[model samples]
Target: MFKEWARSVRYASKFHRKQEIVTFMRQIDDLEIYANLSKFLCDNYRQALKILKSEPELKRWMSVEGIDDYDTFHVWLEEEREYLMGMEDGLPKKREETVEMEYVKRLKNLESSQGRLSSILKAERAALSDRADFNPAPISQVACRHAVEHRNRDAELVQDLEVRLGITQQWTSESPEWILAEKSIMDHRYLDALDEIERIIVERLFEMTKIHQSGTRYKMRRHIAKALQARSKAIRNAIDRYNTVAEEMDPPKPTLSWEEVVNYGFLAEFDILRDTGDSIRSRPWTRRSYRVAMDRYFKILRAKEEIQRLNIEIKRVVTWIEDEDWFLRRKEAEYKDLNPPLAVQISRYRQRRARSDYNHMQRFWALAKTPGFTGSVVPGVSVERQQARHAERASRPQTSREMEMEVVDERERWNSSQEGEWEDDDDEGEEAEQEKVSTLMYQMSVLAVDQDDGRTHQLD
Candidate 1:
């Protein structure tokens, strides 16, 4: 009966059928039957340990668990048995021992994979931040999101100017300055016309700023400043229209900052537009309009030449950013989806270690039952390994038949060799037999003549 149960347990453990093993054990009622099986299990445990002791990894495991001596090993066997029982009852405790280097290696690989993913995500974020077009501004200022809005407004103003220039609408009225500006643009005298407008605005602004005013002079200056402001606004509107069409046809592109281009030639004359908040000395609105017009003029000039180049640069940056964004997202997804194979490794190690521990327990119980059995009992031989070694030795080729086959194989191999001198005597047998007849004729001549006679005959 015990033999039958032992066979079932062996089959169950061998095939990883844990439930089946439990089912077989549960069918037993007799305490003696359990005892007998337990003894057998102990014997098997000792057998397995003896076989595994020679393996370096298993030896390291023994050292790690402090199972060096038989007494300590026996104590460990008891603990393992209880742990296995606990697993069968309800709660399964996972083995957290770092004894297996393979488990550690798997953990390291998972970390490395995740680390690479982090690097990709970080690079993508950096690329996103590097975009010059994505500017966010304060309550008082402009932002990147407003670029299209500003562009559209500029385009509409340009369209309005085009309608006025062509007199496309029946009810449209044209100002003389606007008409003159339009004619200059058509005639390709853009520089002359633009300069003339800029000169008129600048002269008026210079006069207003230079005026040293008492009460009457101040009043007169204020009136003149009001007229200058109105004129500057009208000229700026025309320039804005011209700039809009110029930008749409060939837009100006800036790689870093357009503020430099906008602020460059206007900085010194721009002080009049600064808000000093001093009511007594507040600069007129006309001065502000002139300054803005000057800035617009510079922007239009710069755009007329470099719009396409700036567009190409912006496109390149935006495209690179988009590519990086996609790559980063892909890496992030991979990271999120990362499921390390460490679980599988852990399962495998647990299965093997459980097998080893169970066998050790069975051996300890067997030793306990034996009369006068001491903890000093040590396995002198690994029966399973010895059998395996014998099996391996038996499978190897040997003796006369094998040697003859090897010789035939060698002959086949040697037949392909080009060098004649490397051939063995057996291989050169025909050549040696052919050379024997020539050697025999030479020997007969030597025997027929004395040493001196042979020498003299050879010389003649």
Candidate 2:
């Protein structure tokens, strides 16, 4: 409080560095930075310790009652320089405009990222709530509060990132896709868990920015990519929602279905059966056998496609898990309501279903082959219809045996031609002449009557 003390604290009131001078100052654990203050405090340590020990609240505030009380006191005394300095209203205002400005710079950096994200999340939630028989529970107020609190938190986080990444200007979303990678990472859904947020936040933010209609000059081909991202996102969300249900509720067992699985496996159209199988094989998600997994995946997502299929998969998942003694009690009361249980009668059921499916599939193929069934991959089309269309081309006229024969014949002809040309072309004329001369000389000898040099040249 004295001029000497003020002078000790400030000496010159100079800052250590530009950006985080205060934080750095606050972080200084040594008495060296405040050597002047240390001397001033040391001169009065005895009296200060004596007076401070008397106050119970002060002792509790710093837990001054213990053996380390002096240590706490000294540390607090030094670090509290800022706190103590604040008490003096006129104590040379040490506002770090640069720090605050740096924070503002951070917010600007994340502006586009935050803008596009929640709009999508909210839109999706709203849509899901609107469907017939769909009951949308208002996001739990806790979730709502989280949503609210998250705004500020995200803002702060983005700001912090800008500072850390040394980003000065806001990223212009060059293409919707450029932002998509970042934006997708921000999504709580895409993340393994909320705890993984920090690492993925920037990633999602980028993904979000990628799909935005507004792209910056710095970006390229990003629009097309983002357009694809949007298309894939539309399908992925539906699949993800379908997969979250418990196994017993669906015909197929619910399991981990990542974006890579759905995008490459389900939506990728096969030139033959949409050829998604090959793509599925190549994906990072392809480690496990996906045939059964695919059924489960289809089951969960089928609700969005065919409500009937949706119901079937849901019941399958629910029942599989619910019926622990599935082996012992193959048939049960629960199986009665829907299409009859496949039970241990799976083969028999399959035979019947196969007959029904064959008829349906046959009809589908007939229709598709008839040329009127347009190639429409509409968002609103029934999943069964989609499957029907694909199944029509399932065998895909596999290059026909007739065609294979033609290929073989063509190959044989080519080989025959190649075989005739295999000789040493450079010496052909020389060999022909040698043989011709041998014949001609024999004839010539007959004509010449033994005296011509040609007869003698024929050797023995």
Candidate 3:
């Protein structure tokens, strides 16, 4: 009986401790801090509760002592404080002890997390070494050659597009758009860089088409031309914008335009004499040289576009994170509680408060039942046992024979249903045949009766 009383006190203490921790968490202003602490406290509470409830001695004493009233219960706990603390089986740990232990546990967990993260990094590094750090000289020789050839063709196409657009490499290098784009990237102004790229691309496309007089069979030529044009314009714009902001001088003046370069080529025609003494080349600049330059320019343009795109996407993601942080802080300040614990606290408080004004007839006759103060709450053993049984059933694995039996039962049901359907069809056919035979019999009987009547009339 005394053990049961001690167990009852332990149970009450566990409940009180949980209530206090939950209330403390609900009162906290910061959701993040509360969230971190609440889990620790809740885990401790659950462990303590489990220990207190599992004591079989408490169940026996609960029926003997009829101390169900809240006020009486608290008084009993206060009077037996020393005994309650002395019990080895169901006592809750002190707050200081619990906190100190939890701190050590968390520290160890943090160290474990760091170790795990480091191991992951090491694994990833090893994978990168195997995949990306190997020599490419032998493996990529053929592919590299093909890539170089393709790049050369693209370069030639870009050079043609530039010539048709009436712009030179020198003019693009000096353009305000190109200059601004490079400056923006250096300054880490990714949005500005993106804007510059857009402007450069649009202007180049518009001007290139305007200046274009002839069409090419290769459609890639048009795309390559536009990409190069946009890239040049964006770079110039970036430089121009950067110069204006930094108060820096503009780049050296452009030496030539597309028309000037073309006209000069025609005017300054220097003949190349071959060492063979008989064969002579007309000029130093050939179609092949221009084609090689076009390929290089195309590669440069693609690289710039990809770099600018990545920079802009990264900046946008950073901005979104910042906005989300601000929003959460604002909401936290504006509301009393924005998380689950606060809601739970409010509901719990309301439920307890609602029971405050109740007048129990049983309490009034409490003195009559003073010798036997039993608790209203049943020991949760039966309930836990039932739950365990349910969990076991749910988790139990089915044998292969059981699975086969189930399949067999399903097939049998399906076969029976098919047989039922066939029987119904047979019954309908039999019913139709019976009706046809009955009709024929009735027709014959009527004809016979008619013939007999006719004979009698004739005899008369």
Model 2 agreement with the true structure over 249-359: per-residue lDDT tens digits: 313333434433433322112111121122223432222332333333333343234433322433333223212222222232234334334332432433333233223
Candidate achieving the largest TM-score:
1
lDDT of 3 by residue, 301-331 (tens): 4544543453343333323322332233234
Sort the predicted structures by lDDT, highest score first: 1, 3, 2
Better by TM-score, candidate 3 or 2:
2
Error of 1 at 373 (Å): 99
Better of 1 and 2 by TM-score: 1
Report the lDDT tens digits of candidate 1 across residue range 275-383. 2222212422224443343334334344433433432333343233223322333343344325324433433333333343333333443443333221211112234
**How high is the CA lDDT of each candidate model?**
0.40, 0.37, 0.38
Error of 3 at 158 (Å): 3.2
Candidate numbers sorted by TM-score from highest down: 1, 2, 3
Best by lDDT: 1
Worst 10 residues of 2 by lDDT: 370-379
